[model samples]
Target: MAQVILTFFVAYGIVVGGALCGGIGAFLTHKPPLLSMELLADQLKIFGIVGALGGSFDSFLQIEKILIGNFSPVVKQLAMIVVAFLGAHIGTICVQWLVQVRS
Candidate 1:
């Protein structure tokens, strides 16, 4: 359906955009954006795209879980968006550091 496709596109965009921001931040800080391609490949092989996407949207998922009954819909959505960006940014930094240290 159109809705499902649109949703996937939006999620992908958010995740990738966050990653790009993180990479840029690292570059600005003079840190190399090192990534372990082999490990990433292995994770992809095991988890598949759907699983990876779910992982990337963890902030959204968690926020949805915790805020579903207590907060206004708009508030929950906005909070998730903020958390997702921050989570991805932090995740990228940690991953790059891990790869750089391992290699």
Candidate 2:
């Protein structure tokens, strides 16, 4: 539990700190950096919180375990879909611009 929380914070720091460094570099070189560091900081906080919640959800799930594959299929399916959507959305939103820039 504590380990997961610590990892989330550390990961968030790596993300925001790297973005800040890149933003500062761009500012020094007179480039726009695409997005402001402040905006990125706000986004990182949101992203980290959501990520932690999603990752820790299973641990906190308060459902009784069933025998012979008798879990709540609807909830399981919904969770899977939600997680997939989140993964795709994050990948697309985060990397779309970078991909375009490289082309």
Candidate 3:
């Protein structure tokens, strides 16, 4: 139980840190959404409330694995999940930069 709690804490920290960095970087980049160029263009509709803000983007990749019928080990799956999240956050920040921000 302690180990499980510790793991959860660690994971939480990483995710939170990543999100903060990503969000701030994204703000600095001021890039618009790939799907929408205007403010409040609404990009979350694509996820249909399933993947709301703060949710890890890794989820999509896990779904992809299920669709692809590719069986990865538990550890590998976890790694992929982490990778997905990191990539998404980083990519989001980059996108923001590309669009250019006013503030």
Best by lDDT: 2
Candidate 3: the clashing residue pairs are 29-96, 31-96
In Å, residue 29's CA in model 3 sits off its true spot by: 24
lDDT of every predicted structure (CA atoms):
0.45, 0.49, 0.41
Candidate 1: tens digits of C-alpha lDDT, residues 1-103: 4533444444444444444555566667886544432234233332233433355465355557545565565464554454444444444444445456464
In candidate 1, position 74 carries an lDDT of 49
**Candidate no. 1 TM-score:** 0.35
Q: Give each model a TM-score.
A: 0.35, 0.36, 0.33
Question: Cα RMSD (Å) per model?
Answer: 10.8, 9.2, 11.6
| Candidate 2 lDDT by residue in tens digits, 1-103 | 4544444444455445645666688789987665554445445554544553455465234233444455785455345434444443443345334423431
lDDT of 1: 0.45
- Clash number for model 3? 2
